[model samples]
Target: MPRRIVIVGHGMVGARFVEEVRRHDPAGERASLTVFGAESHPAYNRVLLSTVVAGGLTAASIGLHDPDWATRRRVTLRTGVAVTAIDRPARRVLLADGTSEPYDELVLATGSRAWVPPTDGLLAEDGALADGVATFRDLDDCARILELGRPGGRVAVLGGGLLGLEAARGLVGRGVRVTVLHPHPHLMERQLDPGASGVLAAALGKLGVDVRLNVMAKRWTPELGLECDDGTTLSVDAVVVSAGVRPETDLADDAGIAVDRGILVDDRMGTSDDRVHAIGDCARHPGTVSGLVQPGFEQAEVLAGLLTGADPAARYLGTPLVTRLKARDIDLAAVGDPLVEPGAEWADASVEVLRFEDPFRGRYAKIVLRHDRLVGAIMLGVPDAAASVIQLFDSGAPVPSDRLALLLGRALPGEATSAGGPVGSPALLPSGALICRCNTVSKGALLTAWRAGATDVAALSKVTRAGTGCGSCQSAVSGICDWLAAAEPAELGEGAA
Candidate 1:
């Protein structure tokens, strides 16, 4: 008999695990699988929630799984069902409805929940879930915020991290006056350096967002805005908290599983109990919790290899601190560290320090280097350059011989390709390369759906949810429409034109 696997928490990680399992073991009689999710729908993309709030995407475009695909694979997907507890004694999981199911091996992909730090009056009179106070962790949260947001809404996003900034941008696109409360010295302190942060802060300020740093929310008055540590209050419509996250580990701990910051697992993602495994945001491998899709997919592939009677030589190292913020009209990506101490012996840069700051153009870029090695850099405007930089980083290409050629309106001689990209040209188009760091959809995927008969942006919106949440990618999606039309002019008709 094939091993029976039960996975809890159907977010990106859980859903991806199932996909890998089916792909590795296409003959399902070899391995039976079932996934239990607390949400109402099969895993949709959480990264695109902000876009949905901005009216650019619908529900379908962000969905990652298909019901018919699951049925055809004989994968049982149970949504709207919560697993209350895991009865390890019986090796079965107890559901909220009191039914119990047995599993030869259990995988806890419970994922993390947004950390809502304790604050004052964030509750109703009886301490119920507050109306004006919600989180942006899932699709439901985005839907609630959209329902509450109106023509003239006032919103305050707690936390200046990626999600917090994305939420603020979405609310702003909805015509809501938005304020971002961050406890750090600068926004995205983890990704961008001080110089880059300054550029980003200035850019956000120009967009009318109130960027307050080194400020912590001391309390939340649902009627008012957030009360900061300095007694200054930010008055707004709703308090959307993106304060960070704590891994969901109650079940793992209760089962006598070892857990530190998260459920402790080895490189193989096998927890203390050999019979129990974990992946995604919840599994704290010796390496950091990447919190990105790529690492989680890596974990799934490794486990899938082990389950399929393969040697399973794969081991996850860790994900670089990469930030691709999907904010309104912004394209920013940073890998490794953007800010290093002054006089640090960094990689060589063949290009001179390219500086472009035009308040009129709303663009700023600071590319740092040693000879031609990309150590760290930041981009304020000129999003088209992001892909080129990523390509350089990936290929480990040496910088151009002429240092100044890296500056504005300059491309290394003979480096320009047919796509008009630099010599290495990430070859990934800005439209398809996931300019919107939020949803993470490639331009190719969007075009595929369009050519497959999805019509109009709205219809495309329903299929891809590209511009739904943040509106930053709206223009990018429009560009994709043009690109698609140019490729197949006859099919798109006036819609593409």
Candidate 2:
């Protein structure tokens, strides 16, 4: 008999676990899976919610599964069902509907929730969102913000992190005047240096966003807008909070599971109870920065292999930090340890740092190297440089001895870059070179999937998930598809150049 597996939470990581399980146990000979979701709708891509707010995509367009997906895969999927408690002794989960489901193995994927700052009037007396206030977390929040945002109205975005910045950009794109409130010296302090942050703020300012740094919201007045700690009040139509998120771990703690910051898991994603496993934002693996989808997706794959007995040796160590701000007219990617102190910030003479800042043109490029290998980078408004730098970073290949050439998206003599890339042509990249940092998709994977009938960008994304994560690699994936089509014009059955 197949091992019975019950999964809680139907967010991105949870849905991915289901797919990974089916991939390993294709014939269902290893595991019988049942998934429960608190939300009424099926899984959708939450990363693209900002795009939806910008009118670039409809809310209906980001569905991860079709209506018959669960039925076709022979998996029991219960939506709009909340698991209120985990009955560990009985090895069953109690549902809010007063029902219970026994499980031989349990997986928790309850992702994080949007954190609303404790500003006055942001929350109602009952602790729900107050009127004229919204959050940028889920689909419902997206709709609420859209309703409150008018073409000429003003909106205040709290926080200046990736999601917060994305929300500000989206709202501005909708013709709403937007102000970004960040309680830090610079934006994206985790991923960018002060210089890069200044350049980014300038770029956003040019795009009509008003950015205020080191500012805190004192309160939100529904009738008068937001009051800041600076003793100034801005009249806005709505306040969208993207302060941050806390992992959803109430159920795990209630069930006597070990949790610190999140449900604690080992390298194998097993919690204190060997029968219970955890992944996604709700679970904390040692040395991983949570609240990102990439880590969770990788964890799901690793856990799936172990549970399905497909790859018994699979273990998730950690995901290298990669941050991308997906906003209009903004192209930025911070990879690896970009937080490493720059010139004066550190006394390490062994580190080699290179920087090029063109604030006028809204471009900044910084590369950190040690032992002749690329370690980290910050690239904004330089897509070409980003592609080359990321490839070198992922492959641990030594960068060009001429740091100037590498920073400007140029190659040394006798390079393939004449075809318009620092690394020459996309075809010349090492097969192991990573193309999509968010999805961890490699060039070789794209080639294989393309040969298997995924000829265009959309098809390749569907087959290999190249352009789905942060969407920063969409252009790169499209370029690879074009190159493949041009390289083998006859082999592409359809959608060929």
Candidate 3:
């Protein structure tokens, strides 16, 4: 008899876990899967919700599964069903619909919920969102914002973080007058330094967003708009809160699972109970950080390997995260620890920092190297530099001696030069080099899919699962396809020549 696996949640990470499991257990001789999702819709890309808000993509465009996907995979998928309680002794999970399902193994992928801070009049007496107030976290929130965010209307966004900035930019594109209220002194303080934040703020200003920093919301009402802690108020048509998110751990806590800020898991993604595992944003491994989709996808792969018995010794160390701001007209990418504001006494002696800032042009680049290895980087308004820095960081390559040239996107020594300039060829990238961070897809995997007759970008994406996560690597994937098309004939004629 095959092991019966029950998975809770159907978000991006959960869906990826399912795909990975099916990939390894195609015959279904080892395990049978069942999934329970609270949301009514199938799994979709949450990373592209900002794009949907910007009118670049519809909700249907981000879907991950077809209607018959579960059926064809021999998996039982129950949408709009919440797993309320777990009866460990009975080895069953109780659903909100008064049903139960037995499981030999259970996986938790409940993900996280957007956090709303304590502000007056933000919620009703029944704990429902007040009129004209919404949190930008999921597809439902996107739809609500679209309904309320009218052109020529005023919208107040609370928070200056990545999501908040994305929402603000999308609303601005829709012709809404946007005012971003942030409690922090600078935008994206975690990913960007003060100097880069200043440049980003200037760029936002050019996008027609009014930024009010170092202020918190005192209260909010549909009639009176948002009142700040500084005793000031601004009228607006709607309020969208992108404050942050908290991992959904209530079910795990109630079920006696070890949990900190999120569900605690070991290197194998196993919880306190060996049969119960956790992944995605809800799982808090010692080495892994939450909120990014890359880490969650990595965790899913590790867990899938163990569960499918394909690689029982598989262990998840952690993910080296790369952060990108997906706002329109704003190009920015940050990798590893952007050692911003290091102590002056130890800064110069410990790490070499290379920085180039042009506030007038809204461009800033900073690269932090430790012991001659690329450790961290931040690039804005420099796509070429960003691509090179990310590749170097990903591959653990040595930094070139011409630091200024590298910072300016010039050709590194020993690299082939082209008429277009020093942009490295896609063919030079190692097969293992990651091209899609969101899905953890590598260049070699893409090439393998292409060699298998998946020639076009869309077909390659469907086959290798590349360029599907945040859609940030779509251009890179297209470039690789173009490169492959040009190189194929040359390779075939090598023996003849």
Candidate 4:
């Protein structure tokens, strides 16, 4: 008999786990699967919700699976239903509809929920969002926000984090007057240093996003708009809250499972109970620095391998830290820990700090190296440098000796040439260099897929999921497509496929 694997929460990571499991046990000879989604609709790309808020893409365009995907895979998928309880002793899942399903193994991918701050009047008596207040969490939030944020409307976005800034830019793009109220002194304090944060705030200001720093939302009422602790009231039609998120660990907590800030897991992503495991935002691993989709995707792969018995020795060490802000008119990528101080004991004698700022040009670059390795960096307004720096950072290879050129994005490793070619040019990246961090697609992988007849960007995305996550790597994929099309059919490495 096949091992019964039941999954909870059908967010991006949950759906990905399903796909990864199918890859190993395509014929279902080893494992049978069932997935439960709390949301009524099928899983869509949550990373691209910011773009949906920006109006560049529709809700229908970010779907991860087709209508008959489950049927074709011979898997059971239940959507718009809640898994209320996990009967651990019975090895079954109890649903809210008074039904239960048995499983030999339980995978938790519950993800997270938008963290709404305790601003007065923001929540109704029934604990729902008060009128004129919404979050930028899901597509449903996007629809409501777009309907209320009509052109000429005034909206107050509470928070200056990545999500807030994206929503603010989107609202401003739609001709809605936007004001970003951040409680912290700078935006994205966790990802960016003060210098980089300053440049980012200035760029947002130039883009018509009024950013207010070092201020907290004292109270929020539809009639009075938002009242600040600085004794000011900003009258607006709506409020979009993007403070942060808290992992959805209620199910794990309710069951007799271990949970900290998230569900605690070991190297194998197994919970305290060997039969129960967790991944994604809901699962807390040692090496995850931030709550991006990449780590979750990596975890899903590790769990799928172990569950299917394809690799009994497979273990999930951790995911490297790399975050990209998917906002228009601004290019930003943060790798490792860019906030390391020069005077800190660990960084004192060994670390080499370098920074170059050009606020007039809206550019800021900072790199912190220790022992000839690219340890940390914050690249802003420099897409070329970001592309190459991210490559060097991920490879853990020695950076080029010419620090200035590397900072300016004019230098690269020996294998790749940078002679006037765009930093995003496929020729300038080593074959193994990652072009898309979302699906972990590499330049070599794209070439292999192209040689195999997935020639265009859309086809490439369909086959390899290169530009599917946040759509940040769409241009890079397009550049690869153009280069492949212009070159001879068998120019170089045509047999890679």
Which residue pairs collide in model 2, if any?
Answer: 416-424, 417-424
lDDT of 3 by residue, 14-70 (tens): 999988999999878888999999999899999999999999999998999888999
Q: Which ten residues in a row have the lowest lDDT in candidate 4?
A: 414-423
Model 1 per-residue lDDT tens digits across residues 1-497:
98999989888878777877887888876679988998897888776777788777897778875568679877888999999888887889999888988998798888888887777756677856587888878888887788766658788788988888888888888788888888888888887766667777777887777888888878776666677898898877678888888889988998789999889988888998888898988888866554565566667767766765553686767654445677767766665456654455542333334555665555666666645666556666655455455545544577555544453424433221211122222123433345333334555567667877875666665576565433445565665555555554553343322
List per-prediction Cα lDDT, in the order shown.
0.70, 0.86, 0.86, 0.86
Between which residue pairs do clashes occur in model 4? Answer: 40-80
- Candidate 2 lowest-lDDT run of ten: 414-423
Q: Against the correct fold, how does model 3 do in TM-score?
A: 0.95
Greater TM-score among 1 and 2 belongs to 2
